[model samples]
Target: MDPKTASNLSFILNKPHDVEFKSRDLPTLSDPHDVLVAINYTGICGSDVHYWTHGAIGHYVVKEPMVLGHESAGTIVEVGSAVTTLRPGDRVALEPGYPCRRCGPCLSGKYNLCPEMRFAATPPYHGTLTGFWVSPADFCYKLPESVTLQEGALVEPLAVAVHIVRQAVVTPGQSVVVMGAGPVGLLCAAVARAFGASTVVSVDIVESKLAFAKSFCSTHTYSSQRIPAPENASNIRALAPNLAGGADVVIDASGAEPSIQTSLHVVRTGGTYVQGGMGRDEITFPIMAMCLKEVTAKGSFRYGSGDYKLAVELVASGRVDVRKLISGVVDFEDAEQAFEKVKEGEVIKILIAGPNEKKE
Candidate 1:
């Protein structure tokens, strides 16, 4: 395929465990609010990997070949006539989901829950893993001088962490316990600390991940692989003896049954618990324990209205150092290898460069 004639060069998942590069027509501005971006970097999220391995996540099945990426940042190549916020050559981080503005959830400022949301890399909606992509001008946040396109790509996951922190109502001087030490988990811990959590304890099964957490954002890290699920609460409390009784806020970014069960136990009475990760749809939950403690448990989805903006501010302000979680990066041609590394659970966060860049 001639580079000049090709409309788009994209890394697509033809099916489960099968991904390849294909040429397609260039995407045009469908709406006046649309801005065409020359993609610079895209972070491979866990959901993208799940789709590659399992062919689906819950009801969002991969019925057709779809582009595979959502965490992305790029430079604006074109802007629609009415688009005023962004211009050509402006660097931006794209918010992958476009929700219907007329929905009740949207009207109430909880647009992440909008039923008519068209999310990238979510089944029908093609993602941003391509040479060029189009997104609403409002959803594309311009990056500051200090934030690189690589760090801009991290804004998506950081937005998720911000949403989790916001939902949990993390207050100053509160004790926070974050389960799991993957990218999101680490970001959650980072956001919690940025939100003014006095003590942030990170619990994970892997020692390396725990070490990363301790160095990244966590005040302390604990290896919980050997602890029984039921004893996780007490074990976590023992690690953070500074907490009066238990964690004031427990955010389970692990989504493991044991982690979820442990969250209910570790959170102090009248404390908040936020479910930030996606594991099995069904689990053996300790319902009675939750009720007995009157824990305010809330389920966090992607992100809300101010999350992306807040995430950007957090990055630009240097309070939440997103670059700390970046373990490695690969060029566009090595996208498959990057995903493979993620599958093998070898890195914290790996970013894939755009097609214009040479493999390094």
Candidate 2:
């Protein structure tokens, strides 16, 4: 261990809307396959905000003083005896979820669904907001010289987009409409284009968000506030006649009830619809239209096998650029303030430097 590594400082959430900086024990490599990392950058995710403001997401509740953050990148500070793929000083993007390799889902190569999976920032599991995080060597991906630490932190979310696109089997010469102009939505659009979608339309209530989406990879932008939910599909079709025939797929990143309903009306017959966003646990669906159109609706979770690797390839190959989506990068002391901006919809993606505070 480095001589500077004594104790660790972390941002902890005592409860809903209550955050504090606390001294934490320096993590040691307990398993031979584990690698201890000095966290360099951690992105503020929407789920983190949901936990901060609501104290829980679904069954996961923050009853204890849990550390908050998951999208993170760092350098290996120490490696266990059995680890060989990475060593100290190696830059890496830490994959936050690691499942028991003996589980049914693991055997089936869908480890993201493993029942015994433990994910960072989830209740009862401390996250990567601290100075040092210990993760499995296999789960920590080495970053190439071309990818920055900021881009590395973003790979987590980008992996989510990759999984969603893969689920839908996005293909060439197809028209895709993505609802919501949030960070994930924008990335989804970018990935859709990288996946060979002919036309990509982004829908949002905010013009600034739509503009941001267009600036990235959205071929067309629509303001949902101006168009009523009932007329969204029609207006989008009229605006882009090539898309008038109906979108080949619709990915809802907004998770709004209206967007969910609009998806049902807009997708072409036998089209695919993937829910990339999370909103109400239960919402009304246009089952009749769905059944009649034979639209295949699928829900996407975090990420699974081969997703993270592909995300890194997308960045390394220069096929998908994530830096444009970064709105700000703040110091560890200002993390709470950054989360406040997320709550107010003031920023797209903000990365908080680790407690050690190193710039790359």
Q: How much does each candidate deviate from the true structure in C-alpha RMSD?
A: 1.9, 1.5
Writing each residue's lDDT as its tens digit, candidate 1 over 286-317 gives 88878988999999999999999999999999
Model 2 alpha-carbon miss at residue 160, Å: 0.5
For model 2, residues 1-360, the per-residue Cα lDDT tens digits are: 471654478999999989999988877788999998988899998999999999899999998999999999998988899998998889999899989999888999999999888999998999999989999999999999999998999999999999999988999989999999899999999999999998999998999999988889999998885455558888877667667767889999988999998888888889999998999999997888789999999989899999999999999888899998888999898889989999999999999998787654
For model 1 the TM-score comes to 0.96
| N/CA/C clash count, model 2 | 0
Assess candidate 2 and give its TM-score to the true structure: 0.97
List TM-score per model, in order.
0.96, 0.97
Q: Model 2 segments beyond 4 Å from truth?
A: 1-7, 226-228
lDDT of 2 at 196: 97
Candidate 2 lowest-lDDT run of ten: 1-10
